[model samples]
Target: MILIINCGSSSLKYQLYTPDLAQVVASGMIAKIGEPEGYIDHFVGHRGEHHRCPVPNHRAAFALMMEYLQSPEYHVIECPRAITAIGHRAVHGGSVFFGSVLVDDAVMKALHECASYAPLHNPCNIIGIEEAQRMFPGTPNVVVFDTAFHQTIPARAHMYALPYELTQEHGIRRYGFHGTSCRYVSQRAADLLNRPIESLSMVVCHLGNGVTMDAVKGGQSIDTSIGFGTFGGVPMGTRAGDFDPAIIFHLVKDRGMSLEEVEEICYKKSGLLGLSGLSNDMREVSEAAAKGNARCQLAVDVFVYHIRKTIGAYAAAMGGLDALVFTAGIGENSAEIRAKVCEGLGFLGVEIDPRANEIARKGHPNISAISARAATLVVPTDEEKMIAIDTVQLTMAQPGAASVQMGHAPSTHGVAAS
Candidate 1:
């Protein structure tokens, strides 16, 4: 069994995959960690139908996951011994790791050092790693970085127009997020298109509670919508997105709002929730807009406008795009949002068939349209599976890895245990 861990600020999601069986034996999530009313929701099998219970910390949450997976109800395996390796989804690898690596002392230290770039993510991620190390001693752990995949971005695309000293001293530049999703969906798109990924150019849209559009040319990121921080590009659940820096001074100096107060507006008091004066959920926004709520309509409009504009920008960035992919929550399920975003891309040779967009929800091989110059696809992102694949491949490549217990199972794709 391969365990994959994704640690967020207030949540920890995990999945146990039995490669030989080609199934997710167990999966769960702990929500509101560090909060008074934290809870764990664990499920066995592919359906993920299970229970929710109080879980306080990362260690406690992990223990809960382990207990349930090993319980007679789930019956994942006999013990931790059945689990060969652990895979971690690390958010910001900085410029250090261009690919996955077997976690060692040096790699752990590097992850800690890179926490400055991702204050909200890397710290918690490290905590999970440290706890897992203590709990599953000697087990091979692999760190699959979210930013590592985008390390191929060219200097001209990642660099800012700043002083040489500042750029070199601070390491300030564009390092896009949602790279795992982008990598997975792009590869899926390549498969759907029946072409070599290395020979294709595509623009991938990762729209969830957070949004980012990436320009992938010949299987490598050339440019992306996000910047130095994860808080740019299109507006998201709570992020302001593409706001003028000058507005900060105006709020602090003229309006007399404190820095913290101003920061809240940008990070928490904006986006669909703020604009619509309703829920942050796109489904709710769509419902309100359907009821002719003007503010909700405006919020949805602005969101789609930015998505379309970024799609155009990426198209131009990659010279021309061969395909446009939509993934994540909003992109995959919301036919309304998908259609609005692709409304005026005919000039770029992209068009979405209304019926196709509506039917392309759930599962793979959802092609919205193929006749357009650039095919528009809705491919679901599988970051956990990607992490597991990376972990298995990298850990088994090490020196003395021949003895590593890889569960002797086939992966979801029927690949044998490494």
Candidate 2:
């Protein structure tokens, strides 16, 4: 068994997969963490069980999940060590660790060093690493970075036109996020197009609570919208996204605001929520907009406008666009946003079949019109599976590697056999 874990600030999502990563034996999510009554939804096959219990912290949550997994009803594994490895999703690798790496004290130190870059995410990720190591001692664990895939971005595109020594000395450069998702979906798009990945030029819009767009050429990320941090892309649920550098100065000098206060506003109180003076959720914003809320409608327009403009820019950057893909939360579910974004993009030969887009929220392969020049698709990103695959491959490459065998270890092959 290979268990994949993705940890957010207050949530943990997990799935147990067969050694080959072919079948998901069990899956569950722990949400609303640190609450008095956190919720858990567990699944096996088509059956599910929901429970609301006190999960004050990630440690408690992981313990409860372990208890459930070890119980008879959910004992898909005969023993703990039968599970070969635990693959964790580490958010920011920066320049220190380019790709997925096996977890160790040194690796953990590196993650801590890079924590300053992703303050909102890396701490929680590190928590998952600590708890998983404590719970599954000696079990090989891997860190699949969200920034690793974007390392392919060339210097000319990634560098700012600022002082040469500043960026070099401070390590200040465009290190893109959502690289993992970009990698999975772009390749998936290539597969769907029935073309070689290196031959496809595509743009991927990862719209979610955090939004990012990538210009992927030859199966590698050449340019991406979000840079240096998650707040560099399109206006997301809470983030203000790519704003003018002068705004901070204006706020500080003229508006009598501190830099910290400005940061707080741009990162948390802006974007859809700040613009609409309403909820950050698109569903709610769309509803309010439909009911003639001008601010909410404006918020929607702003969101759509940025995406449309970016698609044009990135398509130009990649020379020409062959495929356009949407993934992540809002991308996978929002038909209205997708349609609105493609409105003025018809000049780029983009066309959407209204009915196809409406029914394609669950990662449907094609939402473009039959006669459209370029392909439009929604590929639900499988970062967990990617994590699992990398874990299996990297661990197997280590010399003298062995699975931690339990007393009741089955004869069946583990993830390494894959």
Q: Go through the candidates in order and give the C-alpha RMSD of each one to the true structure.
A: 6.7, 7.3
Give one digit per residue, the lDDT tens place, for model 1 in 45-152: 445554556667788877877787788866687888888899999888775667777887777877888899889899999988998898788898988878866777
What shift in Å separates residue 175 of candidate 1 from its native position after superposition? Answer: 0.7
Residue 23 in model 1: lDDT: 85
330-400 per-residue lDDT for model 2 (tens digits)? 88888998899889777777899999999995446699998788888988888888888888887888563
Per-residue lDDT value at 346 in model 1:
87
- For residue 215, model 1's alpha carbon misses the true position, in angstroms, by 0.5
